[model samples]
Target chain A: MAGLTDNANAGAGRTVISVDAMGSDRGPATVVAGIDRSARKNPDIGFILHGPRDELERLVERRKSLRDRCEIRHAPDVVSMEDKPSQVARNGKGTSMWSALESVREGEADVCVSCGNTGALMMLSVLRLRKLPGVNRPAIAVLWPARSEQEFNIMLDVGADIRADENDLLQYALMGASYARNGMEIAHPRVGLLNVGTEEHKGRAELKLAHDLIAENAENANFDFVGFVEGSDIPGDTADVIVTDGFTGNIAIKTGEGTAKLIGALLREAFKFSPLSRLAALLALTSLRRLNKRIDPRRVNGGVFLGLNGTVVKSHGSADATGVSAAVKLAFKLGRSSFSEKLAARVASAVRVPQDDETSADSNGTTK
Target chain B: MAGLTDNANAGAGRTVISVDAMGSDRGPATVVAGIDRSARKNPDIGFILHGPRDELERLVERRKSLRDRCEIRHAPDVVSMEDKPSQVARNGKGTSMWSALESVREGEADVCVSCGNTGALMMLSVLRLRKLPGVNRPAIAVLWPARSEQEFNIMLDVGADIRADENDLLQYALMGASYARNGMEIAHPRVGLLNVGTEEHKGRAELKLAHDLIAENAENANFDFVGFVEGSDIPGDTADVIVTDGFTGNIAIKTGEGTAKLIGALLREAFKFSPLSRLAALLALTSLRRLNKRIDPRRVNGGVFLGLNGTVVKSHGSADATGVSAAVKLAFKLGRSSFSEKLAARVASAVRVPQDDETSADSNGTTK
Candidate 1:
């Protein structure tokens, strides 16, 4: 993992992470605090923090651990949450988000982390690092807390693009599997196509086509195709990877989050209803804290952008210090493992077959 | 509300519910037990139980409360969970699901309740009772437990039709608002178009068009338009009615349910971890029970089919007695309110303007 780092500033055993210190809901101090936390825990990690130089300098100076580990890149402009992706793509030259992506593009960082507008970050990443060869649509893959042995499952296209045809879904399946393999270290990930039902005849026409395509490439792609899975299977043990179009994937994740939040709020209200319950809550505090740690959204905060030339982890814009640290941790892990290169190779190999067949048929009048 | 019942067998104050005693995961006995529970609580509720004569008769006989309140309708065939929607629509004549719908169609029951296959039941309902005027696509509206004052919010197109166009989404907004009004008694319900994000430009093209259409019809349809809402808004105070296509809605609801179940499992596991937690669990039993009742999926068990000629409530196939009783309660509420008729009237009024304008333009060449 150490040998894979090509960044000159990343010393002998260190992994350099590019971070946009602006655009997070909590501001640059929280981001610096987060990196400080990561720096305190891991000595081999370094940061290329992008933001207004003077502001970031003061913030970093206050955190002793980040003082030697962080280097600030002067990017005076900040991308607001409301910025349009197209506008950002066309004219986002001096922004912190743009500067952060440039570090990865220039091989000065193993991975990039940002808590900016998702659309803007995606737009900037695609514009700067570019899509991998043979990759049509890049997808955002998040690790969903699950009941599986691994404790999480990978779901993709969680809002990279609104629509995905058969080919795009096939790419998601491969990319998701690659993520599960590299990010989660699963030897052979089981991929499931998200549908209304597990039945063959269920859901849209494109889903049916995608089903066949995913199944056809599963073995070659080094994953087991679990056929169709419903929304329930996203957190279930049915598969390691759940693949779907951005529209459905985005809604499913947010719905899951909302439901969890609602239940958590209800549980708190329930415990506060009476004196006896409040006493019980005190006695159960430790158990509750343990459960909270296991399911805390902050613990699994990053949504990795797959099918990109460089690894980019998009942290929740509203993330706190813990959440930002979690995102940085995920970025560091992927960086150390050279996840982006492996993902590009996997996608290119899986998509190469049909193109090769077309070329062969065109040249020799024979199908492979 | 009591004066709305048109069923002849229904007592002067009774609302008659047609129930398919077959197709549920638990068999006829559980269905009988469920109706008996409802019968014991609501004296003004009656049932037209549909299933095989001998099996249903014996089951109904075991439940003393149901002896006088329930009337058996002989239908030997059963609609299994695996039955295809098209197959059932074409050749499901003597099935209990078919007979249950017949009672509603023939005005012998105010509302129909079924635990059959969702697709099959929807297909059969559309085939039997038919779609109401101006409804291009029918939807299934479910009451999702929320943090709102109403305690639950309504979400539509929850697997009635996998696809909904702009006009179809407009119809859903109308139907969902009507359901919230008639069923939940929420006057001027706020309706939101479910999307990947709350932003106007975040989702698919259809969503953008649907957003405009829903906003345009909000005043005429007698509902407040909250514009675009993310999946998080489904269980939120932002909107009383959430409108989306069946594909997205189906996944969202299932994902929500799955997440709730997972959290519930983890909470239980957390409580069972140590002896101290076990003691805490015992002390917190009442509070936990209160919390359970508030978020229990079974408590809000029915998914009401909207935009149809008659009201039909689809209970979860695996519903236990409590779940079934909850569904019956919902059906009774809609039945007593003449929800189907009110929904039809609401949809007709909202859609009439455009057609009237087109007609006037064709005849006299002037815009309204």
Candidate 2:
């Protein structure tokens, strides 16, 4: 356990992250600016930047702080937004995204961060790092800004795959709990199975089976299974880790984001309704700005890929410098904590006993 | 077609709706108040209120408009919120929910309105009214306030059943289109299958099959099939009707509602942050009020159960007079337009051709 955990930073004095400086909508300049911002704030963090050597050298040279703390890796190719995952998996050897994951795989960096295509990044990370021993399918866990004291809840399987059987959902619960324990520093995360309703008898059969299975092993898994929760609980403080299949999680996250965007647009429109409203908006600008900063997506801009041997944080493709800096900060935090090894140990220790299988099968039959 | 379509208000001076005056959190008083509000606006509407005759008569007598428009029924039993669907199906004969649905089944009313447990209401409706021919499952359609010119897009399978095969989703498209045409007055509605991604190749296998099936029959069904849509499209103008399985639709709608509520609360908190912000809030109160009214859930309070022989409008259990009145207005609109007959005709005509079975199987094989 010690060797595996220490492999990330080993004898290093500072945490190092490999960043994929390609496929971001804002280009590598924004990525460099973001790294500069993050480096200015966190002097203990270093970066192994992966991109075209000449372009990255010039970009890093513009910032004295980044130039002092960053290493450049020349990966001339990039995975485009339109690149198919299968194509990238087969022919993505020299791409920046692939190189970033390779650094993590080779233990040169603690973790990897990318603002590239999500599908391509996931595929490359899975291909390079491989899934954990007992993990059926990998999941992408995003920290959602919610009403909890921690201000965020870890929601998993956001878009790694569209399907999750009962067993897969149980794995999400264990993996998400490990993430919360390390990423958010929660001792015993309260895990909730996302469903249509909070009733024990509601939702799909798979969900019910997952619910029972999660409950049966919550004690052994070192987490509190809070039965089932509805969509409202995602933003509320009902759970620390909300687990579901990729399809529903993806839809729910997008829906919440879309609603937030809609409300923001409406707020602007409302403030500009008339001269008096415009004056009011000007007067309340400070309060509105504070509110906006508190709920900004950039503040929680990294999606951690779980159930893999190494860690990969996927930042928003169109993230600006501040958003990119936030993602970098997240990667640094996870790296310093050796999140990958802790997660791996947690998953490994959470072995489902054979007797539990008999009980799970019986519950499945009843639920079905 | 003519006979069935004209049966709603055939030779009658007014369209009558049967009301289940039970299981509402606010009790019969709110139901009577809602009826009074709707009756005041629409003189051509009548109601057969189901509940204890003495209690309903007393409540109706409080309002002169309701006294004239409502005819009280002697239903002594009310369906409790905790009643299971199976229990309701076995022995719900004397319940107000049963009586209200019976009115629609017996042709005494154009539609039925209830503020009871949604699951129980759907079960009773399906048992009493039966599914329309060719319809594999019934779905509940709700009007989602969106960025469209219509201001609301119809979304189906909000919480009917948790599962939907390819055939069931195609039926949702047809049923949702019919509801939009009659309820929103759209000549031809645009239908989109809700998926994790907008790409035709993304999302679940059944969704891909449903997409092809919907596309192949969009012309025949007199609607446009707009490939796949994400959760954002539910509140966008891209599609007039968003279709998905019950599980996803229910979660999305609840998630949207929860997000809206959270934002609304946060806006209030922001406004009351300081004395200056409080002043600004007061100054901009008018504009804020207008914005609130535009997005108020009470205005779009009804969920119309589709794919059944008779229409059942399910209002929020905790609805006040305004929300209940909005639901009543929806029921009246569907009743006036003979929505049930049009929906049945639409589903009956958009038949899945037998030869397409081979193509569907082959596509499923490849996609799966």
Candidate 3:
């Protein structure tokens, strides 16, 4: 991909977000309209939108606020959702995804946001920004609707990779804690290692080692390391940050989403069971709307990638303008706080424990 | 522990279920009461109740139905919920769990039911009944609430052990399919191997190997083997039997349970949010009751231990009379159908694919 030069005319204090305006299910028009929405709401933010120049310009021209706040970078190629990550990494030159991330690499944008393929996005980010010095693997952090007043708990390594060693888990703890502190403004986020049981001796060998390692560094990591937590604690108030390998984390997340949707459908069916029940549902419309708003998946649509040198926020592929705007808003917040830099530092500082030490003690046993 | 000896007095046509009448949170009274409830509804069923002779006799005397249907076997010890499996294995003699399972081993009962510590029950079951010949690992199967009119999907290895190789997974498929066929009465039930994705290339290495083995054995196993399934399919109707490693299966089950409870609580809070909404709640009470009954965990509370020489049903530790009765009902159904013999045949037939093939090929590659 041709590098989009940094915005030389922009003021030093201004924040510019790079957006990959292609590959989303809603198409480029919706992506541009979403940028328009964000731009209108916050005049202080600017964008370097990556896509075909004529197509993006037409959409941006439809909104005066977006045209004024956005600068288009022409990249003719697009990464389709079905494209394999390996295929994209090797031959994805001039694609909008590569260009958008390039802007971040070249210091043209403070953050990068895309509503494209998740695996492809992660691959691109790792290929472009690279893992932070001490980080062995990157992780994806998601916000789950939780029981606390905050209404959200952060879970990490959702699908970055299917594996995590003991040291990787410790790094996820520190990185997730840092994200929670910066993103959620929690002073000292409580971190829990997800396990089969709360008992110390339960689960696989690595979880045990990870449990001990997290506890050992809890003070320096600036988080409370709750010994162990079960899957039920994911949406509970027992922990603010839940850490697990991507494979288990991904399964838990999908299972939770599937269960929620099933219940919601069942609830709707119940409300429509009879004329009297329909009347009751009509009467409870306001309360039901309030409840729906609280549990809406679209409201928490972005999964931020951590452990990379740059911040990349991945919106749901099927996100509408509202969801796209939400992702943009998250990217803007992290950009303002320099979240990527802080996360890199947090991971690097926690890497003082040598990886060889694990091999020497032969404590590197895995669940497999 | 003294053997209760074979029940020479058992009627030729009756199905006997050994019941551990102690250790449940509701105590022996509830166990006897549950028996009374089942006896009133199921005339063909008889029970061999295990507990202290005096305490159980008093409870049984309260119900004339239970007095005639139950045979008391004095077991003065109980397995506490906190007892470790290893500890229980060595010194579990004279305990109600032990005697209840022993009844099955001795052919005094067709099946055994207990509402005690799960780990302890599993330990006792394995020690007394032993794994079926040709079976390498035992599994626990639970019925999940599903989209099918059947109202449930059977999932296995909920937490039997934290590991399963390709052969073990293939065994789970056959065992779980046999369960669905005999217990749920689904002829040629569809079996699915749970993974992170539906794509053939998407998950762990063992999953891929297991996938091939299941597909290869589907016809002989007497089930249609779907290629791959995600966590979402657990509640969907895509597959009748979902099989995975114990680690993933355990996490998914607990996550689903926790998510269901969380949503239920949130819905209640929503209904009580305001006076007007509270009025709506009162009007919707009947529909809500119907909805609650459909999703009630108590209605489907038993976890059937598979691959064992005898069928053992583990009810929830905190099960009340209703939950215990549900478990007893399941036990009765399985006992009446001679489920153990059918499952053992199914597993033994599938075991013709030798465990040594996997060891020689070293196809034990895991996702990690």
lDDT of each: 0.88, 0.86, 0.85
Docking class of 1: medium
Give each model a TM-score: 0.92, 0.93, 0.93
Tens digits of lDDT, candidate 2, B34-136: 9889989988998888998778776777676654567766789989898988998898899899999988999889999999999999988988999999998
Task: Please write out the lDDT profile of model 1 over residues B25-137, one tens digit for every residue.
Answer: 99888888888899999999999889998777777776767755678878999999878888998889999999999999998899999988988999999999999999999
Count of steric clashes across candidates, in order: 0, 0, 1
- Model 2 misplaced stretches (Cα beyond 4 Å): A1-11, A352-368, B1-12, B352-368
- Over the stretch B81-111, how does candidate 3's per-residue lDDT look in tens digits? 8889899899989898899998999998999
Model 2 residue pairs with clashes:
none
DockQ of each: 0.79, 0.62, 0.66
Name the candidate that leads on TM-score: 3
Off by over 4 Å in 1: A1-9, A62-64, A354-368, B1-13, B62-64, B354-368
C-alpha lDDT of candidate 2 relative to the true structure: 0.86
Which is the leading candidate under lDDT?
1
DockQ of model 2, rounded to 2 decimals: 0.62
Candidate 3, DockQ score (0 to 1):
0.66
